[model samples]
Target: MNDQNNPRDAESDYADRIKLTVALLGKNNKASDVMLARQLGRNVLLEELGAIEEPYRALQPYEIDSNQRDNFAVHTREDIVMVYSLAVRANEQLYEIRSLVRILIALLFFLTVLFFISVIWR
Candidate 1:
């Protein structure tokens, strides 16, 4: 059978082309960026970055993968950035929560000690 006719072969070919294209785009660029630019147009990519959004804009279906509904998929640079931003934000929030818990615990301990002292004095 011809390679084109086989689903596995076709997928492999597609992935190879993606890798080649990414390489040609230069080391700074990623496969996902090329896929997004091709699928969403270059303007959309710039526009999304320019827009004020926390973390980053949510990725569209086409931006995620040229071939949607496929089990295997590639990610865009924006997706990577967004995920990283989210992780950082989550980490920061966790630190804040921990600090708050610590403060609350200290206050509780102080209050308990004061209550016992007052009872003993009375």
Candidate 2:
């Protein structure tokens, strides 16, 4: 029940998107991949909501150093592109993991069958 086109509405929406993105990103002990995925998700949601006038703001840019700014500049156009790329990369990685799990399951089944055969032959 937004008033539509209100400045506060825009800011609030932006804030909500940022919060949701942060939650989705969660923690990545290795890299900023999670953050990038969350930003991508936020962008997708914003596009769907028809409020893409501005991208969501970074949560804490002040804490990031100059060299590390690349990782925290989620508000820029190039940064948004990187977010999309990261999201796709994450999705592909998940898919690869699923495929590997399926293969392992099949392999385990085959091994169990072989074990039973050896037991019977003995």
lDDT of 1 by residue, 1-122 (tens): 11322323333434555566566665455665757346344333433432212113323323434354242233365567887999999999999999999999999999999999999999
Compared with the true structure, the alpha-carbon lDDT of candidate 1 equals 0.54
Best by lDDT: 2
Q: Which ten residues in a row have the lowest lDDT in candidate 2?
A: 54-63
User: Which residue pairs collide, candidate 2?
Assistant: none
Query: Pairing residues by index, what is the TM-score of model 1?
Result: 0.41
lDDT of every predicted structure (CA atoms): 0.54, 0.60
Supply the global lDDT for candidate 2.
Answer: 0.60
Q: Write the per-residue lDDT of candidate 2 for residues 36-79, one digit (tens) a residue.
A: 55655665545434445422322222243565455345446666
Error of 1 at 96 (Å): 0.2
Against the correct fold, how does model 2 do in TM-score? 0.40
lDDT score of residue 37 within candidate 2: 52
